[model samples]
Target: MAKVLSLILGGGKGTRLYPLTQSRSKPAVPFGGKFRLVDIPISNCINSGFRQIYILTQFNSASLHTHINTTYKFDNFSKGFIEILAAEQTFEHDSWYEGTADAVRKNFQHYASLEPDYYLILSGDQLYKMDLESFLDEHIKNGADVSIASTPVTRRAANDLGIVKIDETGKIIEFHEKPGPDKDISDLKIPPSQSDGSDKEYLASMGIYIFNASAMEEGLDNKDSDFGKQIIPSMISTKNVHAYTYKGYWEDIGKISDFFDATLNLATPVPQFNLYDEENPIYTKQRDLPPSKINSCTINSSLATEGSIITDSYISNSVIGIRTIIDSGATLDGVYCMGADRYETLAEKEENRRRGIPNIGIGSGSIIKGAIIDKDVRIGSACRIGVDKMDRKDGSYENYHIIDGIIVIPKKTVIPDGTII
Candidate 1:
């Protein structure tokens, strides 16, 4: 087998996700109730036999570093390892990661010792399951200098992504980055044969690439900082760049709305992104918590993780994360309640009661809908959030925020009694 190294690019300050990204980097944001966003690509790489990996991170990387340290540990027998290459101001490069390609360029010194034959670059904030060994195999078989995994996306979504035009032989002939609706990209639409006879569908780069080491060295020689915007387009003329069409479920969770919808979809009976595949399980920190205990509660199409206590609540189409606690008479719909980090002790609960504050979970008679209640939030009794009003404006409130019409309760927030959002 050929030597290959994987680099997962933890994105820039994830302002799009906002409050969720307030404390942690985008890759460290919790996903599927339990796993973090970075777990997706790491799990994919592990499943695809790419054991040697390095994750590049810059802003708000403390939680990301901690997660990577505790969760992914390889045995002492093999050459398999996963490490973080956090951006640092060294004597040579004195600035942070300016862009995607720049991140790898800055960390070239660390990669040189590995002397990999090929480099697989992936995005840290996407939801997808791919057999990367097969992807690398195809690249080697085609003898291409670069291979980009492209998925067919609708014209509406094409505006926000890097769209490409490929010839019949799958060689990328043209590439456009974030061409807005005003631009005429009809010429870039994929042919009927390539798109399964679909109309107005174009191939969008998934931000997944395989590069020959020499090609990568040459491509990153200049100061072009981003792959989609500058490097790939420039390489199409000088190097052999081809497109590998992937017809699978893939979603980029960049915005609060996307995160909201994607998290809730996991509660569906048949989610587009399957989390129950035994062959390719998404790995994360394994917690030794007891099974969830539900008493007189009604849950429909919901997923509740370990160490949760639900009493007489109504939950529908929601994902209740680990260590969550729902009080009696609480109702939740279309909500992703990121469970607490630790259960409140008896003394702490008593202290909270003495202080007249709500405990570390949903209080009695609270009704929350169409919202994302982040980790360690405390909602007092009779609180109504995202249920009664649709006229809420998009801005930061005293306790929560409304972004893209979705109510976001940031991590460790406290919503008092009779509160309504």
Candidate 2:
């Protein structure tokens, strides 16, 4: 059996996912009520038998480190290990990771000790369940130096992702990184023979790759900062680069709008990304909390995770995360309430009242629509958010923000009574 070292790029500043990434790293950001964003790739790696895994993170990694240390613990005899390789200022290199390739290149000294046969590169903020054994098999079967996972996507999505043009033999010929709407990428359309009768016109790189040991070392020999922008394009001409077409559900939860939509979509009867798969389950840090308790609440097409208390509320098309507390007469629609980290004690509630602030969670008679209430927010009674003000400008405010026309309440913010946003 060939040894494959999996490297998950935990992303750069994550400016696109700001506010949420304000206190925590992108990978550490909570998702789908219970699990974090990083859990998707880590679960996929473990399920695919890729035992030795390393996550490369640069910014705001404290929570990520704590979560990893608590959740994934191997037995004393097992060789499997999941570790975080944080960027550090060494004597030789004094700067933080400049880009994706730079992050990996700098960590070469650490991972090189493992001396694996192949390197499996993955993006941290993507949602998908892939059988990487099959991916590695394709790379070995093609006898290619590097294999990039590609998914069929339309022109609208092709603009934001790395577009690849492959020949009939699955050899990648050209690569384009985020060729915006103005670019003429007609030549990059998927070949009819490889289209598999799909309406998607282009094949976009999933930022997932399998590189032979020598090919990776050679590809990173230069000062190329990014894999898609610099290394992959350069290697296509000199190396045996192939494309592995993957026809499955894949979502890049990078932008605020993308994150919001992808999350609420899971509140439906059937989501595009399945979290209830029996065999390939997504893992996370298990909090041994009690079951959610609802009191005469009419919940329709919503996912209320563990340890929530809802009373006389009308929730529709929403995701109420763990440890949530919704007071009586509250109506939540198309909302993603991330829930509190810890339940506020009675003393804490008294302190909040003393400070003239609401307790942690939704107060009575509050109506929130198309909004994201972050963790540990104290929303007072009779508060209306995103319901009345549909055309709110895109900017930050005292307690919340409106980005892409969606209201976002940052972590631990406080909104007083009778407030309307």
Candidate 3:
């Protein structure tokens, strides 16, 4: 077996995700109910027998560092390990990562020392379950210097992605990045024979790639900052790059609207992305919290994690996370309550009450709909979140702001009594 190093790109500031990425990197952003976005890639690597993994990120990585430290503790006898490579001022490089390719270029020295046969590069913010060993096997079979993981996508979706054209032999011969709708990209559409039964018109790069170690080193020697924008285009003619088709659920939750929709989808009876597949389950920090307690709460199509207490609440189409406490008469719809880091002690709860402060979770009679309540948030009584339902984007209102018509309450914020968004 060839030793492969899996490099996950924990994307930059995640400006599109805004307030959610306000305090954490895109990979560190919470997903589903309990797990962070980083967990998806890490779990996939572990399941695929790729343990020598490295996450590269530069912006707001404090929470990412903490999560990795506290969660991924490898046994002394095991060779499997995951590590973080944050961008720093090294002797060779002074500035931060300009783009994906530049980030890998700066961190090359670290992974190169491992002398892996192949490099498996992945995006950190996508939601998917993949057997990476299969990807590696295809790369070996094709004898490709670079093999990109691709998925069939509709023309509409392909317009926003890096599209590819593969020949009958599955060798990628052409590449186009985010081709404008006005431009003609008929040459980049998937060949009829390879289209199989899928209605998709084009093969879109899933942002996953397998690179021969030497090829990667040579590819990054240029001043190009991004892979899709520069490196891949430059490699198409010189390198034997191939495309491996993937048929599964894959979503890049980069924008706030995408994140919001993806979160709420988990509340459905059968989500597009399943989180309960025991064979390839998503891994995360497992706190020993008791199972959720429902006190006459009416919940429909919702997922409540362990250590939650819902009392007389009507929760529908929501994802309730760990250690979440929803008081009586709270009506929750399309809400994502990312639970607290830890439950406040009795003493701490008493002190808050004495100081007339709201408890560490949702309070009584609160109507929370189309909202995301981040960790350790204190929602006072009768708070009407997403109450305004305005489509216009505006400045923050008491830290409870609207992004693309969804109410986003930043992490650790306090929503006072009778507050309305």
> Which pairs of residues collide in model 3?
none
189 Cα displacement, candidate 2 (Å): 1.2
lDDT of 2: 0.93
lDDT of 2 by residue, 43-94 (tens): 9999999989999988999999998999998877768999899999888799
Q: Regarding TM-score, does 2 or 3 come out ahead?
A: 2
- Tell me the spans in candidate 2 whose CA falls farther than 4 Å from its real position: none
Better model by lDDT: candidate 2 vs candidate 3: 2
Expressed as tens digits, the lDDT of each residue in 234-336 for candidate 3 is 9999999999999999998868889988988988888988887999989999888898999998999999999999999999999998899999999999999
Clashes of each: 0, 0, 0
State which candidate, 1 or 3, has the greater TM-score: 1
lDDT against the true structure, per candidate, is 0.93, 0.93, 0.90
**Model 1 segments more than 4 A misplaced:** none
Q: Taking the tens digit of each residue's C-alpha lDDT, what string does model 1 give over 1-421?
A: 7999999999599999999999999999998889999999999999999999999999999999999999999999879999999998999979889999999999999989889999999999999999999899889888899999999988889989999999878889999999988999989988766768765489999999999999999999999899999999999998889998888899999799999899999999999999999999999998889999999999999999989999999999999999999999999999999999999999999999899889999999999998999999999999999888468999998989999998999999989989988
> Candidates ranked by lDDT, best first?
1, 2, 3
